[model samples]
Target: MKLQSVAIFVLFLSLFVSVFSDTARTGDWTPIKNLNDPFVQEIAQILLKEHEKQSDEKLSLVAVVRGESQDGAGTNYRLVLEAKDESAATNIYEAIFWDKSFTHFKNLVSFKKTYLILLFYNII
Candidate 1:
């Protein structure tokens, strides 16, 4: 009976660890292609095209999108802008922040910058 109880306790412990560990790992950065968001995918492509045009202080683009604690409406439109350096990121941030449409949609925006933009739209 003692051996059986020990086995059952071990099984429960393993299950608990697996569930919690998976949740804890969700915030980590994943590959840019893992976004799988059509809108974000389009934006990334457009940004990549523009990035190619820069000869100096260039921006190397990677479009990575991720949400917060849950897949709720909170952070669905999150996209991270990684650039060649801080200046590149800042420049990109400025372009997005000053765009007329986004300026009008400012109320719905979670935050905006050349380096990062989390629009109101849902990613999924």
Candidate 2:
């Protein structure tokens, strides 16, 4: 009986440590390695749709430029996307989405236009 109690206690302690370690490393944004990942592209599409609902502008996702993810209560994805509006003029945007995978809940945290700086060279 005493041995069983000790085994249970050890199990609980190990579980606690595992959960704590996972929670401790969350909340820091990490760079996404695969820009061409289908899942990343899907997230970009989701962002465009959500943003359109709020802004009433029909935007289409052209590509997922880059992104980062931060884990916490949910995972927050920050992405730079290349997109075009109804008129088809391409533009860049920085969009953030918070998604809770377990519950399948997601929200568009923010979206705004971003600009790309272009440099030109001249040879004389």
Candidate 3:
């Protein structure tokens, strides 16, 4: 019975992965311990707090910029959040971005580290 249950669980997991394979590729996000930079930390805390207050759904802030970008200057930093789907992404954007408090997200990033936040959950 134990072995049979284990096999079933594995099969289910495999099927789940296969179903969302394409999304896994483009919107792949790595879970992490933390982002060490003080500025990024500040931004993340603000976003997380707002997300929690606005919705019951839990969301994660994954990477704060993709590709080969510089650490502090020149390159723009984009904050990527891993959403369940497009609707979640849209809601997050609407609830947070449209608010006046965080309206200057990109500018705030630039001010802190001369970077930009190309934030969007998973528009694709």
Candidate 3, 12-117: lDDT as tens digits:
9999998866642323333332445675555555655565555554555544432212323222333443323234442222211211233443332311211123
- Compared with the true structure, what per-residue lDDT tens digits does model 1 show for residues 3-61? 99999999999999988774435334323345556755555544444544543334555
Off-target runs (Cα >4 Å) in candidate 1 are 16-31, 34-39, 42-75, 81-90, 94-108, 114-124
Instruction: Please identify which of the two predictions, 1 or 3, would achieve the higher lDDT against the true structure.
Output: 1
Alpha carbon lDDT of each predicted model: 0.42, 0.85, 0.41
Name the TM-score of candidate 1.
0.31
Q: How many residue pairs clash in all the candidates, one count each?
A: 3, 0, 0
Better of 2 and 3 by TM-score: 2
TM-score of each: 0.31, 0.72, 0.28
**How should the candidates be ordered by TM-score, best one leading?**
2, 1, 3
For candidate 2, what is the lDDT?
Answer: 0.85
lDDT of 3 at 10: 100
Candidate 3: pairs in clash: none
The parts of candidate 3 lying over 4 Å away from their true place are 1-36, 66-78, 82-124
Candidate 2 deviates by what RMSD? Answer: 7.8
